[model samples]
Target: KGWGHGIKTTCVTRLDAFVSPEGKMYYHRCSVEEVIGRKLGPDDNLASAKNWARQQVLEGKDWRGKPAKFDPDARLFACLSQGEKEKLVEPGAFHVAVISARRGSGIV
Candidate 1:
């Protein structure tokens, strides 16, 4: 779902020509492992660490750069929109509706 009635997509910028020794590495994902006290496997999804690592790549582009794939501005905007949606809708309404639904019934 979008943030509003007409909002459809949030476009993030990407840098493909970046070059560095650690440009393609996800090293900061190690922080997530450190925080959780374990080493993550290749398939582990470290959402926060992933974003942070991408931001680091952008920064390593010879100057301070922003993470184009996970733009923090867009994140903040989406969060605000989600907060408004939460405020407007009853928190338990969806759960209540689910509990009230008939089980094993086909679409009517």
Candidate 2:
């Protein structure tokens, strides 16, 4: 979504901020119109854009100001220890388990 491709030209933008536990703050500009394509119905456009924006806010914070080489594998178990950080599990067997648990209603 960062590339110029697949982005709408006339759109409103927003600056989102995130503060980590260490009190460091990070900010990024987000384009809402680019996220809502013309192909979508009016209601669908709003719902899809909102969902995509929320997911972007969540995942963007996870990688903010970090090197591209950051290895999330190093912190898998650590995040699991904190129930609130369970969203961190992804891209591997842990992610599979999470999907399974969600389907099984083991997680809300």
Candidate 3:
């Protein structure tokens, strides 16, 4: 069910107010992990994240801050994307996940 998906320590240099599709996914994952207080494993139930987000949204905000469409801050935090073509294509066929990272975020 996967092809070239991975989370390596690749230092992408940029502060262009956006992140790549894959990059969005990474940040989104990080956001979820931050909320849940742990890193997700490959075998974890990803839908659980969605469920938790939905619960949060119903209570107040849509925790799933989709790339470009939402910010990973504020009430409705915008995170990243998964393999869902529907959510993936929400921004556009070729869209970038807008972000507001400080300078040298790419360096680590």
Winning model by lDDT: 3
Residue by residue across 1-108, what tens digits does model 3's lDDT show? 110123345547531122222434434545556655777686655455446545555666432334224444444333433443335433456856656576647844
The model with the greater lDDT, 1 or 2, is 2
* Alpha-carbon lDDT, every model: 0.42, 0.43, 0.44
Best by TM-score: 3
When 1 and 3 are scored with lDDT, the better candidate is: 3
Error of 2 at 49 (Å): 0.6
For residues 1-108, write the lDDT of model 2, one tens digit per residue. Answer: 321112333447644443332434444233233333334245543355446556655665432322235577667666566665655545564533335644785555
lDDT of 1: 0.42
RMSD (CA, Å), candidate 3 to true, equals 19.8
Off by over 4 Å in 1: 1-27, 46-108
Quote the RMSD, in angstroms, for model 1.
Answer: 15.5
